[model samples]
Target: MRAAKGAKGFKIIGTDGLPGPAGGIEAVAKGGWAGTFTYPTGAKEAIEMSKKILLDCATSVEPTVTVGTTAITAENAKQLMGK
Candidate 1:
């Protein structure tokens, strides 16, 4: 209700796409936030790298890996919940 409490003209955007009640996606779905982006962990990439190094005997792997993020807005906020 911050928007109704004089914050009207200000768009509420969240950086973390936390799910569930009172989370970022919920806030956006309920019209409390304008938008948000998902914060993903690199666990999948880590597991792949470990297998490559241990099983394939790779000498080296890329030190940095880029993980993609998903944008959450009113249009797709609800669909992302319980996911």
Candidate 2:
């Protein structure tokens, strides 16, 4: 916020639209950002694959996994934030 103070036409686009006081949601809600995005870490997928490899003794799993993401802007930020 301090960096953009008194600066004209400055915009902030953040990542990890997480919850909490200091997260991207709050930043956007407070007008400190134009928008933000959430990046899935694929931890759940990794765990599931591990289970298949260990329990099922799978020979191989999918070579790649695609995670999903969400875009948070003023239009939906408030709704996503449950505000």
Best by TM-score: 2
TM-score of each: 0.79, 0.83
Worst 10 residues of 2 by lDDT: 1-10
Model 1, poorest ten-residue lDDT window? 1-10
Model 1 lDDT per residue over 1-83, tens place: 55464755778888869998978999899888899999889899999999999999999999989999999999999999878
Candidate 2 wrongly placed segments (more than 4 Å): none
Residue 38 displacement (Å), model 1: 1.3
Clashing pairs in 2: none
lDDT computed for candidate 2: 0.85
TM-score, candidate 2, is 0.83
The top-ranked prediction according to lDDT is 1
Scored against the true structure, residue 73 in model 2 reaches a CA lDDT of 89
